[model samples]
Target: MPLRNPCALLPRRLQVVASLTLAVLLFILLLGSHPTSTSSTDYIHRVPYGPAIQSSAHQLVENLPQIPHDLPHVNTPAWLNPFRGPAHTPPPEQANSSSGEARWYTDFKWRNPFSSDTTLDEERAVLPPLAERARVYTYFESTSKDDKTKKIELELLQVWRRAWWAQGFKPIVLGKPEAMNNPLYRAVQGLELEDAMEKEMMRWLAWGNMGTGILSNWLAVPMAAKDDTLLEFLRRGEFPSLTWYKGLESGMFVGSRGEIEKAVKEAIAFPAINTTKSMFEAVGKETFAVEADHGAIAFYSSATITAKYPLLATKLSSPSTAVQGLALLPQLINSHLHTTWQNTFSSGIAVLKPLPAHTTTLIQPALDIARNLSQCPSTPIPASCPPNKPRCKPCVSNNMLISVPPVLRNTSSLFTIATVPHPYTLTSLLHSRLDLGVKFVRRETDRDSWTVAATKELLGTGLSSFSRLPALKDFVAGSYGEARTLWLVAEEPVRGDSELDLDALDWHFGFQLPRSPVSDGKSVTPVPGPERRPPPPKEEFGEGPPLSEQELMTERSMFMQAQMILRDSATGSAKGKTRGGSKSFAQTREVVEAWNLADTEVWRFVRAWDARRQLERRGWEEEEEGFLGKGTFGRWIDKIT
Candidate 1:
């Protein structure tokens, strides 16, 4: 017997209704199984089902019956509470009181769940005494006869001394007079200046035998005083007898005095030329005619010594073998600095795009001027410039020259190109003509090398200027433009003043009044004013008292609230859309405005608290001034008395 159709059993109207209901159920199941892609705006606006389910489960758990207070509890094993050992039992008087209920969760107490149980006092006990700390020696040889250069070197030495002293390390400065006493120094006195400097450091290290010490150059500034890995290595005495920076041995040296002395003596006795040739042969390169410095000689000698005595020397790049190494004390190479500056200048110009027609027209002429300046003859022409005059040369390589094109001199447009001294003057002139209302504020320095003082001044000025400009702040906070203008100025100069080998001519531009605003054959140059010294280092090093626990907690809570506000605003933007079915830009603007207001209020509160703290600290300082005087030495004197 064949089965009849299911629809034959029902009435005609009921059969049609049953077929429609089955089709609707099938559609619902398919729709739920495969979700369609949604726009970002829709995705943000979608309801969160995860939190809803979590809340429902939490409610169910809360409705369930809890364990009775009178139920017998099992004691947890001591091994389970490894952080704090076994749980403590309540006293006899409090055992039967209401506090007994609190003891039910006593097994969960953790002194420090994240770290070992070793106390800070135990760590401090193993630290070496101040006198026993490793000594770091830096050699300062003033090759430049410029008084300004010497003054800068002295200032750097003072900074270095303070940095090392703060970290409980002894820093010693070596000079020409100290090196003259070493017999090894006298043997290698006839070498070239750079080679001689290296040999001098080696001789001093060998002769001094100053226990565990480091040999470093003056150019290597201390970025941080405290390195836990370095400190632990020193504390445990786990390093080999002689340890140097991994890639380059000359950058830094750290070792015990005895091993370093032996290594230095062997390096000094080795023939420099033969060492260079051997190194070239080892690398499968032909021996080229180049002067062998102390670095090469030392590397060769150390390799030879290590072959016989494996434990005498080692090279380290990181704290452990498993971790990658980073340069802690980077040697500032001139070529590297020039490349970095070029990249920065190009990238900065690249971000300002879709330039005005007027700005775009001036770029080619500027490039021509740059090319002309770069190709100018080495000698000064009397026809182009008169003798005994500052403007004798068509172009000068020094940083002092601020060249302005003849066209924009009288345009009534405010254009300032703040940049380092590049080989091309046209780059700065073009930057000024961009009409961005930007004040390019570059710190002027006397030295050829980049200085910390210059960096601080530049950063401070930029930050202060940014804080005052709402447009700049918005540009930084929002994504607005793409970087595509770099190719436009790719033909510009790639070298700076430091990379040039020519002597800088003392040239200044003579600006004549009643000059035509149009492009003329004559270029306008404004003489830079007298040099200004950077602010004192004390402000950079000085730190105020740390934030109180309450202040810290407030900051954490505010940060969390700010994060939540940002997240909610992102999702709520779709809800605040107009009738056009688009996310409202007005809503975004309102959110940003609200955030700025909240930020202003928060800053005001912080400033008020800081002012109050300063006042309190001042009062305490004034009270102590009577006995401590003004300096740290005075406080020590008072203590001694």
Candidate 2:
């Protein structure tokens, strides 16, 4: 208070001047140690703090604006961050290792889904050596002490070995006299019996290197007729036309070694390949490169050829013996035309006749054979009778003559149950005559009108569920008493036929696929201390080599002759005098040659068709049951939501 009195005493104008001089002095004192800059005043004017301080003390609050707490909106990508540009970038080593491009990009080394080394090894270990590659597993359980049963088993084994030999594979029988007493043997036999055959089939296809396997019971003998053993049929250059389940007998599979390995690899990598419901479904989706099991003998046999030789896969349509039958007359005509007119026949060959829709008309050829065999007028009474029967019976042809149409249903309906003389057996004979085209129709239907093919197809609806599935449920659900009985009888070979009597017996078959055709990297013919042949000289690039006109003509003639032979042999003729049987010649040589040429393609087509047909039947049944609209909950959800 005392010092303030001196300034108050001075004049007002002098006081103001004195105050300004003091302020300048104070600013100079504070800035004395720092470097002087003209830009300081401009910097102070640009800052918000400087402007607020310059305002009157009471008005400072009004000049300054409030700071914002909310974040600013941004739409820019992370890479385009302005604040963290090149100058603020961190070293890659210090940045996130698991993020960005490194994490998102795929490595080429681990691309295959099936590339599990451990899994591959385990699967490979299950396969036997090359010497034992193609194995056909079968079981027989008989609980009787009869000579007939013993003879049947012996005959069956002989036929099985013959069929296996024809297919170029070794047969290993898995049954014994004491097979019924051992629990372990029974378990193995049961697995072969109860498992759905398709699993082993796929396994064989994947692992079998050009190996064919059959997993069937003792009843599944390979014979042209019941009485004709497999060996006899092969000797005569014939295959059985009538088989259990038609084309699909019991567990049968065929494929090349390379394809089976490839398929297995693909299946391991992509599980869906073996998980499809039907073979055709797999084909439709191309899930697997190999063919599917169609449960038909024709399909299995034909597809084996296609699998071995890739060229025939797409060369034919409806590659079945049935279609081949209709081409017989036309092929014969073409052969005659070629032999007569030579060059003129090339421009116009005869078209094949359409297959008759009526079952009776198609079966006529087969029926004629039966008639001729039954009427052996020259033989004595007992010798003239059909083999294996006790007495002579009236000829089927004579009985059918009374009916106007001579149809199976009308002609056989008159016979009582006891006097029928097993008419059903004749069906196979007819089937053989028709090139295995006959379809068996069962009684009991709701509809009144239908074509023969359509009727048979309709009857087949829901059949796979009952037939294709393994009998596992029946075995598992069986009581302890029955299980004990099975155990007790495991090694004991009772004289019971699995085919006819199944009350106390059960069996199953299993097979493994082989890795290679030749075993242990060894040649079929061993070399003498690695002696090698010299390499052939290479030819020039231009047009290869020259051929004479005579050589070219010879090749063409031979090719045409081969084609004729195939058509002639695909379906055999009855070779009976008069028009009684088919008027065609039974050319066994042609049959064998044609089979060798076309067996693969035929098997491929039939098997694929079997899958397609089975699928179709299932769909048709589902539609009839109203399951298509109501059963699928996914569709309901889609419709509602």
Candidate 3:
């Protein structure tokens, strides 16, 4: 008793020590879990590489940092922009990068832009001169109305010039025989392809040279101007600047706000469903009286949940008529021939919902057979499809009309009226390097990286399908003489500021949204920088009050420097409350309808739905019968059977 057993005492002592050790370890683990953002340029990608600094390599991804901690409000810290999610957090510092020219041909097989420095031979190959006169882009005010098709043509030709995309770059885009000169091509042209080929073809056809329409698009200008230093105007198929001259036919010039607005407007379109009285009797004799609103709700929910389709909207706006009437009077005969096809196929649905299991049971079978060889593989297809042939898998039914058709099925007119043509004023202006842009007095790389990171994340999260997802073209479209600094904007939505009215009728929600930076799948990492306060915003708009969120977005698009600070229009504040507003019955329904019309987009979800159908098509016939009759996508069909 006097001396406790020595062994026992030793055991007790060891137990105490072990408890203490465990506690300490837990403390360290907890501390490590706490998010701590360091103010360091360690993770920043400061590439001497041309313009773009968003790192693509995985190792360059810093720790997946939560949205930055101390970003200046004026910097319009991305975190404050509500609607951002965890995946949107910036990557912690330590991301490293060296000044390397952006390798243009990284993914493509034929091109290797990164192998060696830009070789003289390669450079020459991309930009071959043809005519003695190099083409120069010119911006002008048009006296007539905007021409939609012409606008696309101008943009298409210019993009080819800048990106060095030729006819070869264009995938067959649907080759099989068509009842009307490629229904697939016509169906997706303006709404998707942007009519690049038609513009080139029109140019040739107008000149009585139908055979060489594509050749004309090559834009064969001479290597050098008469003075010899190479045409100062054209480079590698691109004419950056719009040549300003008299009698050059007036063209449309919508401000930066207008372009952005066009984008947003397209996001808002939805099919109008008649919320009139309709009776949906259950499979049993129990028929309940259904209200119009209830019917719409039921139909929309059933369509979305069953098909998983997202509605889509398209901007129906025409480009400004700053320039009209071609220099070479467009041949009426050829114009008719080229445009006739477009008119026939120029239409697309703004909203298309998938059929319910009951309807799809009848329709999808036909669609699967009809669409068997027209869709692209590799890319995920819409929800409804037969298995094994995702690329061109046939649908269960083809003659099955969509949930509802808007302008798409409304072509009661005899001629397919394609939209008018307009030039790519924006790109042309930039190519010429006319040197129009606000000068950034200070340099801030950190700000730029953050902006790029957020943009990439958004695109990856499904915004890529949006027609107006801003990319390399939107950011660096126009030329700024040696753009030194990019602005990190915290410009908020304040009333009474007037430089740009993003809320103006056509300029509001729908149009402005087109330029929203997209997010690709990339870890969010803070941009590196010397960390100085951004200089006072240039007073280009005079002593007006601070601009509202919409206005700020428009201005940012035009300037192309500052990262925009937008209040979620769904919630008119920048406090990062993360709250989303529910539109009224009508408004909300519209968005749902928009999601349904997504032939190309909502198709992924539909394909998912269709996979269930394929599963149903094969065997599983023993499943239960009747409405809930265990159609495709039936989870317990086999179990029930």
Candidate 4:
């Protein structure tokens, strides 16, 4: 005590100075403010997050199909699923013609689950296999001088977790660094490491204005692949790119598998457009939309394109890139047949962008350039149509066409991964891909229209849980740590909005029916900007708008030379499922309900809790390890319960 008095009781002036410093600090915190700090990993959302909202909207539980009683359920889809009408038509052309939609859904070639060794990355890494809550974790394994990055990482995960849990998701997360299992996280526990973390989320929305592939970049971010390229591409600023893009925005194009085929076929009637080795880049993107700090191709161009060609992508493969790789060749072929332009590659006329799946129709734009721009007839140069396709009279022979190597990348596997929530609806999503196509529509972003009918129904049911949602409230409250298992729903994009409402914890969740895409203001939401593109131009490049009969015949003649280029994505490959596929969000709900409503192993664990026994009376690990010991999700549920 005497020693404590000596130093602690420094000179009166020194003590006064210290007190003043502390007071100033308090005053600055209470009155003035400093710029909030964020982590690099506070990272631009690795995926486009769905519109966040807490409302009385939900789909009726009755519409959900029963869990398959067997290890495999027939690919048969239930009515009212993502597929529209009783026929569950994926494409009118084939829905009525195909024997079973089963042939349309294919299996996955691989499923890369979340894996990480770094402590900092423990919370925001890995490509979770679940559908709804794929989380990410990052590590700042830097020197003592680099603790700032580590703190930022931790802060980012915490804020993300808060946002996700508040949105009612049982997130598959990369939790607090201290909670990390890595050896390093253990060493940094005593310091105020989290002090510099930022609590605010920087708000912004990204429309994949990058004209081509949003998938590769989205999936690459969590993998720590170059993300600046994607951000730059979106900004329209040139960055190091495998290729340059001169295409239109996706939202501007009207897409549909069969419809595209129909349009292309009709356009093919034009003696002008030729189809050779059909060239189109998948511009792969993971379509999950939300980032959980884990890895994944959050949304590839295919996912975006599929949003328009739901029935087609669904009929093709699940979200796992592995599955897509297996079906890649086939999917491309299919898309080619539907889109109609021949191989611009062999003919030096491939879509200005090589990959077509991830992009929209720019046939007219390509045609416009062909008309106005002049090219060296002998070279497969940019700006002009190829000179070599079956001698289209407009050009001569000997033009060397620029060619893309027919070799698919190691596609041995793409360098991509997507974290998905588990016991998820991979199957449902697979089926929903083709089968659920009719439910959502383009521009169906209104909050009040029937377009939101399905979402309203879902949130409506989820809101009922609000009465028992104290745990959810506590999680969101952040100040109070309350944990309880509650209903979670992810349907923001269905009704489309940017910010989420905070007080939606106590409302009942509901669902409404899907309406036509043509809703009057009833379905339109105010998008911050505009949707503009020019119409097809008449009068192109050289000879008067009219090419002589010989030229028209020559242009038409080019089609036969590049026949292989016409792939038809409209009719997706055999519908299949694989060991590598992810679970769907819808499937996640069903699984949760199945466990809650029936006698199951998960329920068994929940029932073993003996809350009445005194802590001292039981052995250390044996008694309390009931529900928490099962698995990550099991522990998560017990926390919320």
Candidate 4 segments whose C-alpha is farther than 4 A from its true place: 1-182, 191-541, 548-557, 564-641
Q: Any runs in candidate 3 off by more than 4 Å, and if so which?
A: 1-102, 106-330, 337-341, 349-559, 563-641
Model 4 TM-score, 2 decimals: 0.15
Ranking by lDDT: 1, 2, 4, 3
Model 1 CA lDDT for position 503: 11
Writing each residue's lDDT as its tens digit, candidate 1 over 348-425 gives 111111122112222322322222222212221112221112132222231221232221111111211211211111
What does candidate 4's lDDT look like per residue over 303-380, in tens digits? 444553344456445544433342332222222211111221123321122112211121222322222111222111
What tens-digit string does per-residue lDDT give for candidate 3 at 167-218?
Answer: 1111011111111232223322333212333332222122221111111122
User: Pick by TM-score: which candidate is best?
Assistant: 1
Q: Which ten residues in a row have the lowest lDDT in candidate 3?
A: 415-424
What is the C-alpha local distance difference test score of candidate 4? Answer: 0.24
Q: Give the per-residue lDDT of model 2 (tens digit) for 1-641.
A: 34565668889999899899999999999887546565577866776675566666658777678666346977566577667644333222211112211111112222121112212321110111112224444443333354443444344444444344323233444323223333233323423221333343333332233223444443232311111233232323221221223233333433333443443344334335435443333333343333232311222123532453233333334445323322222222112211211111112111111112212222222222222211212211111222112133422121121111221111111210000101111221222222211112122211111112111332344432223111211211122111111110101112222221121111100111111112222211111111321111121122324435564454444433433433354355333232343334333332222322222111222222223223333343344344212553311110111
Superposed by TM-score, candidate 1 places the C-alpha of residue 182 at a distance from the truth, in angstroms, of: 3.5
Superior by lDDT: candidate 2 or candidate 3: 2
Error of 3 at 488 (Å): 22
RMSD of 4: 38.1
Q: How far is 140's C-alpha from truth in model 3 (Å)?
A: 34
RMSD of each: 25.1, 34.8, 32.6, 38.1
